[model samples]
Target: MPAFSVMGEFEVIQRYFANSGRARKDTLIGVGDDGAVLQLREGYDLVVTTDTMVAGTHFFPDVDPRALGHKLVAVNISDLAAMGAEPAWLSLAMTLPKVEDPWLAAFADAFSETADYYDCQLVGGDTTRGPMTFTVVAKGQVPHGKMLTRRGAKVGDFIYVTGTLGDAGLGLRLCQGQVEVSKKHSAHILQRFHYPTARLAIGQALRTVASSAMDLSDGLYSDIQHLMHRSAVGASLDIERLPLSQALKDSCDRSTALALALSGGEDYELLFTVPESKKSMLDVLLSPYGVPVTCIGRITGAAGKLELRAGNEPFAYEHRGFEHFEK
Candidate 1:
């Protein structure tokens, strides 16, 4: 008999995940429930998002379970951050081929700790035996009618992104053995890939100033299209203005770094636009977040089209971002 079979599903949940994370007052009924009963704060809009990760597809089969757990929470929390929401509740559904006690313990510890770091409570989840996969449903709250979205970008809004890009992409390449890096930089790159941070504070601050916003899950090349499409606007991306880390710059040539920044995906950074009127106060407003912001482009009047430029001259590239069902 398999080791996992020794413990029934209910027992596994109680042992590993039932008491994970904080106990939020808003969660009237949490684990051990047919359904979680949650209370929404008055005058707030409920923001919900879901993400899933498959072992072989999303991560290496032998990757650290602790890092995987943190990544799972960070990615889902990033969506809530993009919407300028305060993360409140999380429900996870885990499918595993087999449960190893040590792996489960490490993963649960990291998951619970990460959830608490973000002030989120794990309300409920399901466990089952199957292929290695994990799914999380994150719930957040934003002030009524003040949530930032990708639909309000105006024709002259300046496109901005939080934090440096392309590091996570390089990190992915390093993990796949596609690139070699100095020992000094390898650890930083690997951590960026394994442990991503959700811009929760910056996102909430953006609600008042940003005309439009979304998190970078797919590469910027692909994600910008979605924002532009939703807002019914076009964009002009300045290749020169993209932010790259010193490590990324040292690891590869300018062009390779640019390509990664453009379409490598999984950065989990915030991509947003601010109207011209808000430009002056933007820096002052976002100073508290302590994360760097870069102006990469501006919204254009040309609907359904994206123009790329390197300072003054026109630039062209055709790299698509990560997508599941592309032929």
Candidate 2:
């Protein structure tokens, strides 16, 4: 029998999830209460994002619990970052087959570590018995009228993405045994996939400069369509200008690497657009964040279309990217 199998739900929660290290002073009532009582900052707009990970669909049955914990918090924080918000609180709901003390302890510790890194408090949550699945509801705040969105792009805006793309896609391939990589490159690739950084500082910095913005949870080819649709614009992506990491380049053919950059999901990097006038100062604006921002495309007058180009030559690309459901 498992060590924690004899413990009841409340006991498990009290021992593992309650009184987390990330507790905030503004949280009037936290984990022990029926609901959380949090004081929202005055003169600020509240932002919220939620994400769920199921064992079979999102990860392998034997994936590391600690990495899973950090990824959960980071991905939701990435959403808040895309909206130019500062993370404030989190609520976790878990469905588990059983409570294994070692696994639960590692998972909760890492979860609290990431939440605390963002200065967010775990205010309240629920636990239940079922197939393993984790859901996080993250709350944040942004200055009034300063939250970024996907609705502000215009024709002539320059499209940019932070950090490198496709590394996580390549990492997924490594995990699935679909590719072979040098030992030195494998760790970097896997880290990119399992522990993505939320570009909060860069996103906050862009609130004043970007015409429109969002984080790339889905592949660029799929997620950029949201920005185009909301802003009623099209885009021309320069294939040769896509940002790719050295690990990604070394792992696959050029075409394959670029394809992954376009089609892979969970990079958790910010994608935003700048007007022509602001392009001159883009580097100066984002330099403090230490994330390389690449201009690989431009919003175009051709509404609703994504045009791919290799320099001046128009190129065709596979029209599919990662999507939850397909007909």
Candidate 3:
């Protein structure tokens, strides 16, 4: 028997899985040990990403476990999605206070669904006793010559983004009860927050064509600026051209909607750059993917600056997006 409801998965692992001396080819040694060893392959370039979701930090304490699982896994996949890598496997390390069968079932189901959708496998994990925290380490692979990166962007490349933005931010506002949303539009915003789709296919396809690429985990304003800064170039984005969701517009005015789309974070879409010459053909290739790819702006010669055009003057805002430490 255990106290305070349950012993938790961590306790089970600490008792059994840890230092059990399980030695597979993939793991030279695991558990009940000082450290774990990894077997690195030579032909395929390994893509690695890790993300942590904490209670009340990344997610609400009262969210659905299935959706929580989906979000946790999707965010990790989104990192590989940015690199145009094919997801292969994942390892989960989770901490929780008790064992909730319903929650675990739903979470596992959602996790399996996402992994299967990407043809990835969940190979290993560890559990612990504590406040709820979920960490996923996702592994992906890219060919020897084909991997997209942020450093390949050029001054004359056309900037593009897949799908709409700001819905997730709006969704967060709704979840926090910070914004008033009508019954008619509540579902859309809620879905955006609960289930953000990772644009993996688009990223893989663009790996060969896109000069530079990244996922818009943050706001477009901040993410685009990051690419500009890294590539040693500047950008001129058309404020009018940003894809504003109707869900946002129905809740707030146009200006507010534009600001959210521009600066609101966690859209999980891809922001990439392609040469001007490939623009037309790329558009045709992207159309069949059923996700809208919009050319919102162009890169410029000036480095480390971002200029937005809203009418004749520069589009100004105090801050453009979310920073992990900023309040």
Candidate whose lDDT is highest = 1
Ranking by lDDT: 1, 2, 3
Candidate 3 structure lDDT: 0.78
Each model's TM-score, in the order given?
0.96, 0.95, 0.86
Q: Write one digit per residue (lDDT tens) for candidate 2, span 66-175.
A: 99989999999999999999899999988899888899999999988998898988887778778989899999999999999999999999999999999988887778
lDDT per residue for candidate 3 within 1-327, as digits (tens), equals 232236544454454333322223554544334444555456669899999988877888888987898888888888899899977777778788776767776777777676767766565676766899989998788887788888888888998888888888888887776788888889988888788888999999897689999998778988887788788999888888888777787899887788778877889999999998787779677767899888888899989888888756788766645533223
The per-prediction tally of clashing pairs is: 0, 0, 5
Candidates ranked by TM-score, best first? 1, 2, 3
Each model's C-alpha lDDT? 0.90, 0.88, 0.78
Q: How many clashes does the backbone of model 1 have?
A: 0
lDDT of 1 by residue, 223-290 (tens): 99999999999999999999999999999998899998998888999999999999999999999878
Model 2 ranges with Cα > 4 A deviation:
1-7, 322-327
Which parts of model 1 are misplaced by more than 4 Å?
Answer: 1-6, 322-327
Off by over 4 Å in 3: 1-43, 320-327
Q: What is the lDDT of candidate 1?
A: 0.90
Better of 2 and 3 by lDDT: 2
